[model samples]
Target: MCVADGGVKTDRLSPAMVDKLTFLRGVGKQFWDLTDARIVNRNITMLRLGTLLLLCGSVFANELTINKIEDAAKAGQFTNIKIGNIQVPAGQTLHLKGLKAGTKIDFVGKVTFGFKQWEGPLIKIEGKGITVTGSPGHVIDCDGKRWWDGKGGNGGTTKPKFFAARLTDSSISNLNVKNLPVHGFSINSCQKLAITGVNIDVSSGDYANGAHNTDGFDVGSSSDIQIKNCNVKNQDDCLAINSGKNILFQGNTCSGGHGISIGSVGARKDNVVQGVIIKDNVVMKSTNGIRVKTVLNAVGSVSDVTFENIKLVDISKVGITVQGNYLNGGPKGEPTGGVPIRDLTIKNVYGNVLPKGTNILVWVKNASNWKFAFRTLWEVKDKIWRRTIKQDSDAQWRGPGQCFADHPQPRATRFTFP
Candidate 1:
């Protein structure tokens, strides 16, 4: 029995259901009065009455169950819907678009997407004022082994991207995603969206390095977004902010991937990532810990960014990197100073790096008003810090207690050259 905006629909209830309820109430009072006279008779009558009341209450419960993806697509603006376990066929996508305001979707079981070798998004969700939540063990299996060939989106078979979300005032929480072929979540054009407790497990790709560009969350053109309490084990960036404002990423654990990042920004003139807060996160055994990369020839800016209370352990390469000459997945071209980074703050970022790991690498052409409070806690075998341009550029280095400290020592030899 389900209740919608219209009315209750129950096969057992007759047209005089209201009258029946009134009569049941009168009978319940009589049973109470009879309790003083015949105790056993009143007790049996009360038990039967309680069972009928329970059934009546269920008739008005507000929840709908959907067993198929098509059923969800055709459902008309339900306030609460439960999605049952189902397998999405190959070469097809499961899309839930244009959900009504205040709608809540609950996932009770796993959803397995069939394997395919196409440029596709296996799941797409778009709506306003919606919330999609899952139970503790709910999973979305992408079956990526059918497309893994040691090359991800770079070459080999063209695999589908896992999920795409375009939402406003919405949230997605407590979902476990696994075996993505290429990238994970693509969040675009969303406002006030909160994503929490999501787990992306692509650890199998580490065997022989089969997964290439399997990023965790690729955020673009969004604002007031919060991504928190998530765990990701992939091959690429755990969270990449391409363009956004007022974004907060906190309390996330990342491993076996490129760590949290901001850009590859400045590809377009409108590409800008500002007012971001990345705090209380852990990165372990990743290629890079925290990075901000801007394309050399592009035009834009990255400003007002804060990284606080972050812990990096066993970082394979550079722990902290800020570069302006980024291109084709690496920093190789001449930095043109087109994209200026300003008002950056790094606080309480303590970490340990592997042997031959560089701690801090900065090659920006124009930067200003930056503060670094990396006391002496950061441990690395190679250089503690290195910068391409000489001369102080208005940036300040402070100790653990905000005391003025000397600049970090330079590397013995530069690693990359333009």
Candidate 2:
């Protein structure tokens, strides 16, 4: 970042510039002798104005590159930045916040963090209308093995969360992250943000005493966000929405973890997940395929969610699960109506769950207006079995926390296709 040092000192000038200025001055003098003195004075003033403008342009460097962390602040001074392989100091974040709008930041080579036992967003980028990108083959090597003791955020060494992206009306893409220490991308308090083609590989932690609670993307307090074309292989949910609305998770792949989920909502400042669409994704070799778990005895609402065109394979746990008894230790043995679910739709979900796992399980209280259309497959004893179950209003739990319907309790039902 170049700035004014007192003033533009022009005591020394290049020989060529001196010659040009001398020639111009001489020409002015000759014209003054032939014409009016006022005309030569006006010409001289214009020449000086041009010289000052040229000098001022040299003081602002519009492009910057830094290899050290301390110099990272210089990036905010330019519209284009290229960050090379650098290691952030322990307990310090590579702060790229509130940059000039339309700034383009490119991550080149490797970005590593100093090992420390602290809560970290290691990297934070917060602003509007910025482009955060990465070069091909560039990797953000978190080297989480140093912190992986299988007790993520519970006990062991206090590990730092990875990226806290609070962007608005911006797009971040093509990031290759590996060995994530804990939660991968915390997309919080953003609007109109798009994240695409960001691949995460935390499978190395699948070993005993390895990573835990490595959620791929955790969204909260946001709206109009789109996460597409991402691949996550970790030990926790591929994507979890604690609170958000109008969110889209599409064209993604999840493996080696608990599958995609919609909260364990409630207990957060914003505990509503609404207008969410999880479409055309593949979840394979995972524990649970798709699930929505609202915390027991908490006050919130999960409404207007649709899971469409999903494909699951080798899901060792429930293929599709929605429960209202979620607790830390385990389910609370019964559904709690505090967090009512409404207007849920599950359509075109076709996949196979191992015999050990159930195909679809819904245990909720005050859940209403559900329409399920499935083309699923599960084999037992070398024979395929398909069953269509639609139960209509066996009993409705219109407890204190049920979402009050205007008329009689709307038909609370479940419909599955054969």
On lDDT, the leading prediction is 2
Question: At residue 358, what lDDT does model 2 achieve?
Answer: 55
Alpha-carbon TM-score of each model against the true structure: 0.78, 0.77
- For residues 90-175, could you state the per-residue lDDT of candidate 2 as single tens digits? 88888886588998777876899999999998999888898888877679989999999989878899999999998999999999
**Residue pairs in clash, model 2:** none
Highest TM-score scorer:
1
Error of 1 at 280 (Å): 0.4
For 143-254, candidate 1 gives per-residue lDDT tens digits of 7878888788888999999888898999999888998899999998999999999999999888784887899999999999999999999999999998999999999999
RMSD value for candidate 1 = 9.6
Which stretches in model 2 have alpha-carbon errors above 4 Å? 1-60, 374-418
- Indicate the residue-level lDDT of 383 in model 1: 19
